[model samples]
Target: MAKYLDSNKVYRALAFIDPYGMTVNWESIQALKGLGIDFWILVPTGLGVSRLLKNDGNISEAWQRKLEKFLGLDRQYIIDYFYQRRSVSTLFGEETQINKEKDIVTKIGNLYTERLKTVFEYVSESFVMKNSTNSIMYHFMMATNNHSGLKIANDVIKPKYKL
Candidate 1:
């Protein structure tokens, strides 16, 4: 990413980590700033699955409604869609889940409020892109949806805080 945009003199970059923002490590942010990006915005979009169908049972109706509202998806039309998922390991079995309501919302907010380390460095450039018309509210919505998953990841990456 830096190589391609470097030549263009694009001094700054904004990576859409997930519509549900990302766990930003300020330490890494300082490092990336050294790479010449004056600033970067983590405009997260929960989980993108444009290749798949529209409706998905794993996701809830309210989740669908919120995602549609954020992504400009029409409410009248329903279709299978994708949202980031997580796994909960138990003594008996592991559960794969997507927490669209309360869980997702906070995982997204931690990007700004909480500080992480390695999670900040991995770009997943294959998945990141630039938004021509970026808005804070939109990014907030995205972050809210991913909050739960991000919190799980945050805990895994920073396990010292775990209960």
Candidate 2:
């Protein structure tokens, strides 16, 4: 896309990025900023991010690196955003325990939307997609420099599925 943008020809593109999981790098999306592109991305909030976030907040180094690369945020910031650190008195002593936040899927979606807002002029409401067991698996969101594109995305995203 950056290559095409450098060309003299005027081009408007509509891109749908549906990764199998949380494999897409943040730099790829950042490259689309200020370009004439309408993008719809499938964020695996539940299937990927939420699952990677362990309940005890003791994520492995590899998983932490993956999250940081995908979300473009610091590991500590991501941990703090998704978990609450509380001091609990154990039988031996006071221990700091990190508890995962409630409704992580929504939080992940909101966080992604906020990140998208940093690059796009207009970001449409998310369309939540659930799995067969009714668990939230992904969020389909559209980002564009044009307001009309946002409106069209809103129109296409059903009310019930809006997040």
Note the Cα lDDT for every prediction shown. Answer: 0.36, 0.90
lDDT at 88, model 1 = 84
Off by over 4 Å in 2: 1-10, 160-163
Q: How does model 1 score by TM-score? A: 0.23
Query: In candidate 2, what are the lDDT values of residues 33-84, reduced to their tens digit?
Result: 8788889999999999999999999999999999999999998899989999
- Candidate 1, superposed: residue stretches over 4 Å from native: 1-34, 42-103, 111-136, 139-163
* Candidate with the greatest TM-score versus the true structure: 2
TM-score of each: 0.23, 0.91
Candidate 1, run of 10 with poorest lDDT: 135-144
